[model samples]
Target: MNISNNVSSITAHQTLLNTSANNIANVNTDGFIPKDTRITDNAGSVRTNTREADNNGSKRSQTDLAKEIPNEIIAQDATAVNVNVIKTQDEMLGTLLDIKT
Candidate 1:
């Protein structure tokens, strides 16, 4: 009946999506080194880390469209799955209460 893990997963994936979208938006901005996002799991809880790229001394934005696009898609899918799981758990809890009454 615990959904804390799913909630954390959804939060992590949302962060990932946000980072990817930011990278894509800054692709045309010069000297913008897009940040990279990673998901870390700690004791069944999910965490997101966003880090800036190394100073490569390049004025061009190093954000790659090919990678960011897929990353965003994957994040979206992960978020959706966690959301669905949370919804199902809520329904099941409601059903259990109904049975008891």
Candidate 2:
């Protein structure tokens, strides 16, 4: 049982690290906000063998889909711009071919 708890904690810590890394990666991103992973003891459990993120406070906002919408839009816009650039290049090539023929 102790081994299982230890493994669970380790896994939680790894997840925390990944979240931190992703936050750091987007630190310079416009309107990008960093998120923190919190592990808390479950009060309902007798032994409380595991921890979870407390979603009662500001942490609750971290996982909010509303907040993520803007970020998703920004990413999509960036992708669209790249696609448009590629399409323009293709169109230009086609135009050049038309002139040659």
Candidate 3:
């Protein structure tokens, strides 16, 4: 198992979660441009990119709760999954070593 890739993915997802939380917190603040998190696969690892929009679509609001809330949930879920994967991998490796001993 490639633990490095899982670690990277967890980090990226955490960043995404933070960005979404920030956007939601500043939803009503004037002149606050919300940030969007973009994730991409780089080889076997994950990469994160954040983009700030000049305007929040056609809406007059500074932030869009409809979008930000769902995004935060998605990011949180993804992060949790990655952490579970890493734990599973570690357990499997330990079991293998025990059998060899």
Candidate 4:
């Protein structure tokens, strides 16, 4: 397994989680345009880009709980999967070295 890809995936998911958290945190703020975050991959490197939402005219923030909650859950699960992959790879390496010895 490629550690860099796994790490990049983890970083992307972490960014997703952070974006969701930020949106949730500003749910009650007036005129707070929640940031929309998107994860993209380039040359096997993952990254997150966030942009402010538009079309919100009311004083109340346009943050949606229904969407943010699921986004956070998905990001958390993805991050966990990437971490598990790294852990499993490490274990396999250890086992290989053990057999070598």
TM-score each candidate: 0.92, 0.40, 0.89, 0.90
Q: What is the C-alpha lDDT profile of model 1 across 1-101, one tens digit per residue?
A: 88999999988888989999999999999999989998999988999889996768889988889989999899989988988998999999999999999
lDDT preference between candidates 2 and 3, better one: 3
True-vs-predicted CA distance for residue 87, candidate 3, Å? 1.1
By TM-score: ranked, best first: 1, 4, 3, 2
Displacement of the residue 47 alpha carbon in candidate 2, Å:
13
lDDT tens string, model 3, 1-101?
78898889889988988998888888777677788789999998899989886674544447778888888888888888988998999899999999999
Candidate 2, run of 10 with poorest lDDT:
44-53
**lDDT of residue 43 for candidate 2:** 42
Q: Against the correct fold, how does model 2 do in TM-score?
A: 0.40
**Pairs of colliding residues, candidate 3:** none
In angstroms, how far off is 87's CA in candidate 2? 56
**Candidate 4: minimum summed lDDT over ten consecutive residues — where?**
50-59
The best candidate by TM-score is 1
Residue 29, candidate 1: alpha-carbon lDDT = 91
lDDT for each of the candidates? 0.91, 0.49, 0.84, 0.89
User: Could you tell me which residue pairs clash in candidate 1?
Assistant: none
**Candidate 1, poorest ten consecutive residues by summed lDDT:** 53-62
Off by over 4 Å in 1: none
Residue lDDT tens for model 2, 1-101: 12344344444545554555565566455554456555444442212123333445442223444443444454455445545666677788889999999
